[model samples]
Target: MNKPDPIPARLAALKTTPTPDLKQQWRDLFDSEPPPFNRRYLESRLAYRIQELAYGGLKPETIRRLERLGEELDGGDRSKRSVRLDRDRPITGTRLLREWQGVEQIVTVTADGFEWQGRPYKSLSAIARAITGTRWNGWVFFGLKNHRGRT
Candidate 1:
């Protein structure tokens, strides 16, 4: 099941604001120089901060649980970083599947990149966008990242 966003309407409205306005909004909310990220990133982080201030941040227990999960996912050495995982970290030899436009899509993981329909892709996001005709975080589209935890 998916958890509902705490401030859906406000988040939805943020998408329409101008870029300059978004930068100002980020400064207003975070009280610091905003990271040089795109509008989508800015809006998403600002929305999170807004909700965090209003309804309180994530519960301590939830944070601990996520931390433990992260360690487990990283093979118990959380400090050791995998250079290949700087972005999407699909396990090699794993098969990724998705359904788009009522069709099942298949992708195979390789050491260098993801393979889709005999073609090699640099990133899963590229494959996902190719399949869907829209920008998508390949991990999220392939169910590797849960929808409920997006915000």
Candidate 2:
């Protein structure tokens, strides 16, 4: 089998040929100066812009990247501001209930009641009972009042 000729030699020969200056005949049309480029600042700005775009959306991958960017901006520590920016961003196919009693502990919502950890609970009290294995403080997880209107 014969080896192919090197392409670099042909490219080098082409480099010796003079090329016409395309911009030589063109004059400045506008007096405005070109924008200054700061690579680090531009990268940080872009990261933040992407993060803002992902906020309050259902894109999990973008949200995760935004969290990482937040952590980076916070010097690798996630502050309350960063957390609040990324928190409660809902995922698709999941309904969010606001201010509903025992919503957090409710694993699955049914027509009658809610289920937690695969156990049948008639109410939040029943779920608490099954979870804590005790009668007292059963309403703690639900954040509800037992009988005295105290959580």
Candidate 3:
């Protein structure tokens, strides 16, 4: 039988086999040229990832960071961190019986009173009782109200 080609020569040739350029392969996979490495882009991408994680049910700290990122993107001024709550003034009376629109349990305060659409109560607990037909949870009603006190 003919002697096999030298193993060393075969191994050397195999080693020299043209290797596909990874960069070009990646560009082809993406169907576009790769974007230049940018610190700002990386940061924004990271921020978006963090926001998704937070909204997907991460811890409060993570949500806070995501919110900060959103505020930064919106050009929000962070120096003014104080929220003024005029608790000394009473709720006085109801303004208009509006309704809660969004999924989040939000109580919108107008010039008159609070209005929640999805909420069980109409005029607070009385409405709540009228709906649920029992005491149920009065605190839920009160909590939705803008009482005269510091929040």
Candidate 4:
């Protein structure tokens, strides 16, 4: 008789496994302490580890390809990897609404920039400056990003 695969059973069991047991499994499989993450994280990582050991991990070529893609996205700067440019801009045709000093303001996103007050603006900061007569981060003014630049 042919041997049945255990990976499916192992993965399913992870959903119900206790957190302490999952940590122990992590220690056994990874030979290190589990991260201080939640139980769901532990379970997910443990499941991946189980399948990785059973069916092998990513191929060397695949890893190299992923690294190359990362380098292209970050311009070879590892620190820049955490910053994603695509997310900085709102989708084209999106309309953003805000109020400043009790006055309603509306801005429409474009393919390359934004339009506000019946005027085309290359940047949100410029629109904010025109509206408030002072410098302001357009993203913050538009509420697309927080003061810390996070979306």
Q: What TM-score fits each model?
A: 0.48, 0.26, 0.22, 0.53
For residue 118, model 3's alpha carbon misses the true position, in angstroms, by: 12
lDDT of 1 by residue, 41-143 (tens): 6777888888888789999999999989888888888555544343546679987766565566888999998899999998889998998889987767776
Query: Which lDDT tens digits does candidate 3 get at residues 1-151?
Result: 9986453453344333322333343344445643332222323333444344444546799889988996887667654433333332225443222212221233344444445553433345554454455773433443322343333
Candidate 3 local Cα displacement, residue 3, angstroms: 48
Models ranked on TM-score: 4, 1, 2, 3
Per-residue lDDT for 98-133 in model 2, tens only? Answer: 122322333454555555666554555566566556
The lDDT of each candidate is 0.76, 0.40, 0.41, 0.80
Best by lDDT: 4
lDDT of 2 at 83: 26
Residue-level lDDT of model 4, residues 1-151, one tens digit each, is 9899989998999987866788899999999987654565578788888889998999999999999999988799897656443366777898877656756688899998999978899999999899899998777777666545665
Off by over 4 Å in 1: 1-9, 81-151
In candidate 4 the C-alpha lDDT for residue 105 amounts to: 82
For candidate 4, the TM-score is 0.53
Candidate 1 local distance difference test against the native: 0.76
Q: Model 4 lDDT vs. the true structure?
A: 0.80
